[model samples]
Target: MLLLFAVIALILNEAVAWSPTNSYAPGNVSCADDVNLVREASGLSANETAWLKKRDAYTKDALKSFLDRATENFTNSSFVDALWNSGKTPKLGVGCSGGGYRAMLSGAGMLSALDNRTSGADKHGLGGVLQSATYLAGLSGGNWLVGSLAWNNWTSVQDVIDNRGQDDELWDISNSILNPGGINIFSSASRWDQISDAVEAKQHAGFNTSLTDIWGRALSYNFFPTLYRGGEAYTWSTLRDADVFKNAEMPFPISVADGRYPGTEIIDLNSTLFEFNPFEMGSWDPSLNAFTDVKYLGTNVTNGTPVAKGQCVAGFDNTGFIMGTSSTLFNQFLLQLNTTSLSSFLKGIVEDFLDDLSDEYDDIAIYNPNPFRDTEFVASNYSHSVVDSSNLFLVDGGEDGENIPFVPLLQEDRDLDVIFALDNSADTEDYWPAGLSLIATYERQFGPQGKDFAFPYVPDVDTFVQHGLNSKPTFFGCEASNMTDLTRTPPLIVYMPNNRQSYNSNTSTFKMSYDSAQRMQMFQNGFEAVTRNNLTDDSGFAGCVACAIMKRKQESLNMTLPSECTQCFQDYCWDGKTASSSANVSTLGPASGSVSFVTDSATSTSSSSKKNGEPQMPQSHSMSWYVVFTTVLGVALGIM
Candidate 1:
């Protein structure tokens, strides 16, 4: 009886193992069940409950859409084959017990395709969808539990449906199946805990914690439905190994100072922390270096004796035109100078000029003399180098020598008319804008009223096309010339009188002349007015006092007088004759002439007529003289 019972027991055990019921029976709890337990324990609020309800509805709709798509594309034969083949080995595919497992696997594949399409459409919207799904899955643990039970019987079928979604249970269960080692459900708290731990570890190590890490861990543990769905993993390891990131992070040495400090630092000052040393040292001290030599205090020290506050030998003016002084301390020093002594000096000059001009003139004209001309035309030389220096007339060369000079032309009339032309040629773009900006600044600063003279030609075709009317008297047009071109048709020849006085010369000939002493006085006055003018800051004026002064010198040769006037104007004028007279005589004839008489005289004085009218040719006269001389000599010899 005992032997029979043992045999029966063995047969029963074998039958149970072979039966499909045992293989597919619910053994492990699912991710969905886990989430339900969490929700129940947490207790959802009214708003949370409503959100959950909506999320569930969306999840059902999405799942149904996935199912419909899957059914349409499904082949039961293919699923059966995949399942049967996969069952023979732990290979990839649906299993032979093709019921819920086959259906779920096919459904998962369909969902995956849908998710891909949706995610690609809009990442944010997909994220919202996933979030909603996760919430719904968490709420409905029963669905996930059932799915998990079905999944165990045919793991291959489970693998197909796994994808990234908000439904914690579905995602977790899918992730498990995709990964194979982790828990079977998407809503498992243990999986989240593991992810949180990994994040904490990265944070502790000073590594950047990103969402990618969480997804990677989840995928590793079979929490994600589709193994490749989350996107490529990005971690510190990847960044450190990649060519681009490695190059970006690589250390490079940079120089801090000139020969005074012969050292290099690994950190780039532009990117990393850098500071200028308040203390000064005359020579390079390698021993005092920190980064290159010894890991000393945060600061670098000099081995040589410390430099006294102001006793350090100064470098020659190695200042760049745009970059300014080299030493980091120089700007601070300049700021201090501007605040104290320089401010006072400027203030005094301005006060003196305003005081001088207050009674004599209502408003002062800020003139920029064109350096290219004989007269100091204040409007032209505003930003030239010669006028920017301390020697205003640029008179270092010596008296009677060509020295670039800046002289201010004072106008009694506050209302001014300005002809502004911008050279729009490729090379002139930079210089032209600077010049125009300066002019605009000047006009705003000194003159309350001004009108720009119009030019007929535009230097740039593009500008002409855009602006239409070429004669429009605004900041427009440019032309290449031997020297700077003036825009006015007749050339702006406004006779600015110091006081109301009638001159005998013609309108064009009546030039405004200021003596050396008078010019100096006016320059001093103008300088003061510019430095002190409240209008300097208003109306978009950049307060370029130095530039304004330079312009004045370039415009007027008068400024060079008593200094470089004679030499500067020598080329401009012939034998001290003004340019106007010389040009008039050479090209336009005398100031006054009758057209009929001039034309007749020109016709009468033709070269052909003059030659024809000659009494005898020079060659004929020379030949006759030679013959006569020879004959005379022969006669004299015969007589002798």
Candidate 2:
């Protein structure tokens, strides 16, 4: 019973898994069916179809035979010898020779000259078409065989050639085996059309019949044998369907900004090439009422008996001026101001229309007299300079002070003076190396300084700290170690030190002292909360220290004090420093000035009790047996 069950299961499984060898599927058609459909579509004659089929079959067979022979030769001969011998044979089809038929014919002469006139001349007529075909086929086969051998032996041959040995023997053999007749066959233009028609027919049939197997077979009949020595034949239908044929069509033109065609102008402001009034600033204006010529530089008498003067006037220099300069000059000035900021204000007009419009202006493609090619001139010439003045000025030495027409007004009170001090300490490298890359996230979120004029790097903490203390209130990025004396003259500092341990005690003391110190009354009436921190790691420790000092100084000047000492003490509470309201302390100023200081010994002693090693005591000691016992023991020990 078990054996029967097993056999039945095996049979059922095999039946379920089995797939039919041949089954009709949608969009599948045979190659023969595809060819017939194409012929029907193209309306080709029976003779044409027959001719293509015969030629294709013969060519494929010849290519296959050639490949086989070549492979065998390659296995037997050295690569260098094979390549040299291979060149003697004639290539087949398009691009057969290195330079095609022209090169082949030039090297070997006409096909008729090489014919065996003494033997086969009687059989083939004057046209010699049959003889040419046969000779070409044989030559193609020989070339294919030789080429394959050369390809296979390439590595070995290259090695010998690179070593600079004799290649003359090989070259001689290749030249001697030339078959001139083969060139004639490939040169036939009609043959290419016939092949093309056959390929088209196969492709059309493959598309309509929905028979992939037939389509593949037809493709194998077309390209494989011709291209790669029949390793596997491909049909023309397959190559067409695979997108090779699609590339033969024409390409689309590239797009341009303006709707006008390339190499043609949409606007002509100067009216040099196209006809229009020269006085008009925008496009072409024919009506003379609104567009009149102007004299840019003229001599005139004004307000005196004989006052000689040169002034720009409208509607004068008509024939001499190519385009009236007055209106264009005014428009150019407005355009310049519109595109630039006060920071990059124009100094003087660099090139006036009269100067730039000279013969030398022709060198500029935009300003070309030919309106058809001067689209860029119409776009850019209306402005004094398209780019910023800073960039332009930096290029031609410094700003030309002698020639400048205007000078910028200086507002000393509104202007801020900032001095940057950077730290070049070894510790900075781990975080902000000298040439460290700015983070992309930071750039996207916040604007950084321009590429030029960034802070310079300074090595060591002392120099940076000193620079910070001495710099303006706008100075940034300083450290606590930068300060000379903490108690005597605590400069207003604003920096978050990297190694907190280095400045923890000093920072605590400074914050507490500033809160209660009387010297803060000399400065402003505001605290450090309003200040901004612009110190990047690249600013270095010195810069940071300087910035911090500046902030402290500003805070002293601006910060207002609360009414009572209790509120003030709470605001600047430093457990590390003494808490006192003593009036005996003297006042001390900034390092550069005098400051007030308090001499409170009791406060100092109390401050020491809050040292790092101190232990905390509970508020209720009466109920805490541990505290009570300790107090009692201390009292008894002191008495003993």
Candidate 3:
């Protein structure tokens, strides 16, 4: 009993009480002393360029494995040999869109299809592609998914998918973000008390506190359960410590965020897009194109160097804080301040917290001693707002309308040959994506900020819906000649928007809660959509994916297209078609059994929390789980 309580006590460290100077504070922070402290984000950071060498070490085997399965029909033995001998195989990138939990779970399903570890994926479905890919970029809700996978030491999506509903599993969203305390874990009071105190610690340590901090902490709980040390100290740069990642065994993870000049116009395609990777966090966009070393954040830097030599800060890139920055849409949780079950004293702290922050900028994440302040004198396109301000500002990546996070992949530095764009944006009234993100990305190329980058042309939303381009898989930038210009040509895009095939994955962008059963249906629908229902629905799906991967590389080598590649292009490529009419659909559901999941309830945002004002985990579980939970809980609480 004592031993059990001891473990429970440690797991519940924050469950009862927590008070520290905030590991994110300057003096108390933990520093990382490897790689350059900072540099101009004129292109990819030197650390990232070096890390690419390590990543290629893993990609060699992965590309070979995937090509062995994908290139069976194509008999270009010498071309394959050239690719292997010269190490010039195609570079692949995957981008996931933003749509809260809907995006996270749905994207996970698609990732599982690409992941060879999934049961029978290599034999009966599309797999090995994720391993072959070099970059995995995500935004908003997608950030939650990608960040969780990397933070957990690169666990497979199938592992997270298969573990749904288990209290200890990575994503236990049965409990809403507002309230993460569940029965199998700690009590509701314990969880909220911890979150409340953590926020206070940041403020007490002399940093600006916002709803993003609280939202990030709660998100960490859902993704990294108590068994994973509750992830309080898990910084994004700590990804360097993961042997799998260090060895280039997993794809590099990039979480996307957008810069917003407070009190300026809302974000648009012109807004600077930023990314958080293990090595650095900055933008390739001309808007303030500079990157500070991820580990050395929170330092007083000027002109990309520390203002005070040898004096730098760390821990500000806390995993939750970075993820929260990308998805600040969750900052709306402050509106639910009256809904939590915190004590009157704690509740007062939240009220004062709101009073201290400007309502207009509550959604923006703060980077104090703004790393780029006054760097415009030496940097290119450093916006005045970024130069004059003492802090850096950021908002949700989706706010700029490029919800799919394709910008980072489109950079010339990456030079990716192909991209699997898994767009789960709620871009339509029915919550289905209508290819708006793609169009926005294409339009940005003509803008002043887009001169350095190249992109494939895309049609409007109406064109997408009318031609069924948004309904299933569609190919963009297929014709190299048409896409080429003075700059480098962009990669072929395999656009896979979320569609209702086997199940309804279209949950509202604002919908906050989902029970285990509903969550599973979303995952299954996404998995099938990508794999063409595990090759049963569309047998040629795997070959088509493989063909897309090899298209640019084959063309570069002046090789002939196989019959399979030719047929795939004819069937799926857009082919300069135009549609003048709009095709509107109410809901793409066979209704998923009356679709009560859409109705307003305590689990949704239209209302407050339940009677206790906390989103508790569902009680639907095997009696055995409850029995063990009760036995364990009774001992921990001294009620055995």
Candidate 4:
């Protein structure tokens, strides 16, 4: 072991010296406003609207295949035929929540169950849902799932899992980010140096770099699978050219973050939420009330106008940087460096980096040359507060408890028929979701900031647990007619909260790593949560999903609902009842045991360690090292 360690150390030292330097790649630019997708206050972008038309056509075909297989044994094909013949297509959006790797893998598992491409998923699966959907949104760790898939041309979650190597590089926990994963084949020194160099390059380019820059760069090795540590030249807009995305063969991906400044408290419903899509970056909130072309984000734009008539910046929206922006929460991961058992040399590197962060400097994504600066295009009261600032800082989307990325899906123009919200939030002590994200969104629809939007009624979080709503799949907005007082009809919401049936998948949000076995267990538990252990109940879970998708459309067409759908609504819809107290509320309760996975074959695994209890970490840390590291690194990184 000593010899192995020394050899690895030497290789790392040599690799660091040879770390690659990244260069800026210019994006296609035009003088026209539409070229940059300059935000219009009226509605959805022309680009998005245009893309949706193509996406709708694609969804129709994908849905035809999915519904045909999903309802194979049904007595009639009239429903499928009607959808095909009718010009109107059902619109679907998936919203995933934030919970570090726990949320990412759980979201993947749910998507796996819905994916038609997964082996053996056709019969009982909500197959083709992803391909049929027009929009997919993710927040925090969930962004990692969306970013990775988008960056990889919409690769299926199974493909990601299948690509795991002998060292378990796909989701390897043994190789810490500080130490660097072996998948890169870079020694520890090389890994650290390469990441440092990448961030330094961005800094040298006159952009402010923070811990998030470093964190995002590190995450690319595991999530992006590119040759460069940061995938430097890759921009989020590049997805527009990928065959799957350009051809509308897959869902449009959106990543979300919240507008937050240092030391400011954000209310759950009022935060000015921002979204990053292929075409642009902006908010639906009245605050900024505009979007700048994502590719030109680093350009000096004031009051919705660029610094020069013919000049706009490029290379600012690096894929890793954008992913890092949505998930700024994990910047805290760097602060936990001393807790790990890393060597003093490595621990000192991380500690020195983090030591410079002042309390207010923590958990922020520093966007210098703020794109919305000096803007008088005030659509809301809060516009003035952010528009005048030279720096636009953002934090985790879930900081205000709206963990699920649902804002973009609620746009009036999207006219979605149904939204499948995958709640992997760790709201409860045991880390299981408690539906707080949905509640926050629901409450926001009626608030001043979200007055124009509509959301299905969701009960309080207490009611969520009291009625066991958080433990199983439940539907909201089953009857839109009943909400006639609202501004518009809201999509039916199918809420699937993470839970334990065969495995305790509620790993802590702070957990930095997991072995492949534990990782698979989390995925399996998520699959079971969504599919009810893949049981076939007379056409099974897919039938229920189909019912949810068809419910709004059927009602719009004035058609009588099918009996299967009626039964599904009754079984899965919230009854609007609230208990006097949640005292007897059942939960997965306290999770115990880190479920161990033993791989038997390429596609097979067995669970062996059923020991009950969350993994415990030692707390004998001497605070001296951590204090010194934080102060030094924070200053050195210019984060202070």
Candidate lDDT values, in order: 0.20, 0.19, 0.71, 0.69
Q: Pick the candidate with the highest TM-score.
A: 3
Which structure is stronger by TM-score: 1 or 4? Answer: 4
Cα lDDT tens digits for candidate 4, 416-477: 88999998987665778877777667777766668767887777565677689989889988
Candidate 3 lDDT over 409-525, as tens digits, reads 988888899999998887665778878777667777777668777777776565677678988888898878786553667899999989997788887665566667777788778
Error of 2 at 201 (Å): 53
Off by over 4 Å in 4: 1-37, 75-77, 166-169, 181-186, 261-267, 338-357, 380-382, 536-539, 581-640
Candidate 2 regions with alpha-carbon error over 4 angstroms: 1-414, 417-640
Per-structure clash totals for the candidates: 53, 59, 0, 17
Q: Each prediction's TM-score against the native? A: 0.12, 0.12, 0.84, 0.83
Q: What would the per-residue lDDT of candidate 1 be over residues 1-640, giving only the tens digit for each residue?
A: 9999789855654442311112111111112211110011112233323433443444434433332322232332132233223331110000110011111222232122113233221111111112112210100011121223222221221232232233332333222212223233333443444445543443343332222233234333332232112111111111123342223211110111211111111111011111111111111111111111100111111221112221211111000100110111111111111112122433333344334422211111111121111212223423222222211111000011000000000111111111211111111111111111112212221221112222222122222223322111122111113124432221111111111012111110001122223322332222222112212322111111111111222233222112222222231111212223333211221122221111000101112221323311112012232343343333223220
Better of 3 and 4 by TM-score: 3
How many clashing pairs in candidate 3? 0
Question: Which runs in model 1 stand beyond 4 Å of their true positions?
Answer: 1-192, 210-640
The candidate that wins on lDDT is 3
Query: Which RMSD values do the candidates have, in order?
Result: 44.0, 43.7, 8.6, 9.6
